[model samples]
Target: MGSVTTSHELFEVRRIAIIGAGPSGLAAAKYLIAEDSYEQLDVYEQQPEVGGVWFYSPEIVGVTPVPHTTPRGPPELPIWPKGSPAPLFSNPMYQHLNTNIPKPLMQYSDQNFDSQSRLFPSRQDVQTYLIKYSQDVRHLIKFFTQVADVHLVSKDGKDHWELTSRSIITEEQKTVEYDAVIVANGHYSVPFIPAVQGIEAFNAAYPSTIIHSKAYRSPDAFKNNKVIVIGSAASGLDIGTQISKVCRKPLLNSVKTSSELKLEQENKEEVPPIAEYLVDERAVRFEDGRIEKDIDAIVYCTGYLYSYPFLKSMEPPIVTNGRRVRDTYEQLFHINHPTLAFTALPQKSIPFPLSEAQAAAIAKVWANKLALPSKLKMIEFEEKRIEELGDGAGFHVLGFPNDARYINFMYDWVKTANDGFAKEPARWGSELVHLRERYQEVRKKFVEAGGQAKTLEELGFEFSLKY
Candidate 1:
């Protein structure tokens, strides 16, 4: 059954539904279409267009529906009190945001960007690329359609998903059943603002000023204001540097010390994580026993919570901790329902390539050209992963060795089908490993040089030129 053949009867897939039309969803559609297996394809996008988080919009969309009130509360209950409404569709991209990964590493295995594209493409470049990828399959997509609910129903003695989707404009709802469902709704929508004492009170005192990085756009809005950017991740660093150009003093608040990782701290003041917000004094206290006064705004780049609001049918829930998707076989298929559901979920890695690989493997699995481990084996795999990776943010981050290992594993799994599907460039896995080594060398040099700020181009060329 895990071997390629022309026998359609061997595979049970019929119609398939993809939740989002973003990069992962688009990749899923592309690979599924390549399989030429499914009879019907339905791609649903809640936004008016594709491109998921890459498509930037200044207009604030719906608020983040309180997850605690939902039937399956947040995977890890947030610090927010009951009934806290967050700005739902806040644009995660800023005007000047560029891809964190180099362009060569960002493309799908079968596709390439424009010849003249930059090493780090901008948000517009990414969105345009996605829109073009969807062009061939746009007819199959239902834009402005949201998957309101996904329920498991028994149809003809087989597992079928009853998808309740609604039009955002007309508020009209429709129900459809599919043989399988791919959830590419993305993990970046719900902002995860860490619980900080007095944060709610501070926001109450200065409405609309304190916001998550999702709500961030132009640095012009932050001009002349003293802003403290939290979370030292990619988004936080980019937003902080951009705001530093206009703000009187832009301070970066992070838990990472110079001893941990060499950071470019020459241009901006870096401080310890905020211990608490002094709402009355319009100040903040750092964990290192320091107090900063007269802060005008606080922008949280604390990343996003893993949200699968539509998935309410699972007994134990897909995401048990709100950080890692639990009980999965290779973190791709749900152990209990491998064929019924899948997720192109990857983190802290080159997203497009990883998604493409995951999608190809899933398509083969659905087509019965690729085999999954037995239920007992899958349970053992999940347990081993949790024990090794630990049940924390580390589980979600497929950094370094883990990312390369997963990608290579999928590429190998896909090849087992012998179905002539797309595969990553020969030796791409080696390149990833080499790239990690080079990146560490670059970081080592920067740290040894006393923490001088360097351009991304300078660091990127170290590996790109060699590769």
Candidate 2:
């Protein structure tokens, strides 16, 4: 970590580098561009175009199920034969996926989805929307560039970042220096499959049968097969529901919570977490002493780890157990090194708007228009957060009302930091909060009605001034 004893030298940000051309990275670029103080702003993306994970390819990344034993750092990009096109990074977007959050709440503040688009737009719709949103700063993005390492360096007694990025296709590398860095690369890259008892042997018995949600492309592969879907989160439920239509009757849904056990869906039955795998019997033993035999596939819909193999150089590491980012203040700025910040770290929240809010705050602070609390104060905030939320993934889990409050808080924070020239940040008013509160219900109604509703009003969700 770089040491800064004075405030004047700490916030002297001019040339900034943003990693990832995803929604969060694009938002960061827009806000940073709005601030005329930055001398240079570069957005690095490994993919050929924008839209991060939403930029889907039929090709899926190979699964690495063990989290603890897995090597740290970004996975090495696959090399193609000379003159061949480089393969794209595998994304979690499946064929039949749609936004769980409605377009009204999911969109960035400055843009709206096409009027003809559904209330919960499809995967391709979002990819197109993000590409369109990135038009203004397209010239600033360096596509096909993968940042391999980011380290803190000292020059002229001031702290700066030395970044090394490699070309995914050419296998060429380049190193550059910047005043600050924003790690907006997103966290869904590395899939997190929990260590289950006898899963390795199970995989040996049924090769390619145990898989993570990242590798899932279509439900057709699971058709007429006995399937067990693990984890009951958004992806788990969505994937399980999609498979139930084609899989064997009563698709087994494994969950860790009693609340999720009550999830009622036709052709799907909630089951306890897996206890052991009976390799010889080709069966799974549940925690409740029930064994389900002849299981064809076990899809771990478990979430991803927060990985930044590039930040391996940082002292007092940021990532641990791939669960949550540590030493972050308000889950954005680094406490010891305030200039180093992150966006879209919170899970179970509206991503697009949340990215904008975080980018706005980071931009304001980096531009010297907004002041951050002292290092001691920032450290205290994180300590309090860990005490309240505990550690691991829960440290960054901002669900429902917390997500609403966070965006609004960023709005107010940036408003106070405004120098009369900054663009207005996204403000979550009572109506937006109300809509967000009932997002699941609205999405459920839409899905139940065949997902044909083109607008919230069409789904009977009206925009009201009153809560």
Estimate, for each residue in 128-188, the C-alpha lDDT of model 2 and write its tens digit: 9999999999999998898999999877766789999998877799999999999998888
Task: Give TM-scores for every candidate, taking all chains together and pairing residue i with residue i.
Answer: 0.85, 0.95
Q: How does model 2 fare in lDDT?
A: 0.84
**Candidate 2: misplaced stretches above 4 Å?**
5-10, 66-71, 79-86, 258-264, 465-467
Stretch of 10 with least lDDT, candidate 2 = 66-75
The collision pairs in model 2 are none
Error of 1 at 146 (Å): 0.8
Task: Give the Cα error of residue 323 in candidate 1, in Å.
Answer: 1.6
Clashes of 2: 0
**Winning candidate number (TM-score):** 2
For model 1, what is the error of residue 333's alpha carbon versus the real structure, in angstroms, after optimal superposition?
0.2
Candidate 1 on 1-467: residue-level lDDT in tens? 12221223344788899988888888888888888878999999877788988877665544433111122343221122236331124457777776656555677766666655554567887888888878888888998787888887665555678899887667799999887889888887667776678777877786765777877878898788888887766777677777877887545555555323334455478788888888788888998889888888778777776768788666667775577777677778877666544555667777787787788887888888877766778889888878988976677677777777777778777887866654332225455567654554544454445433233344434443321
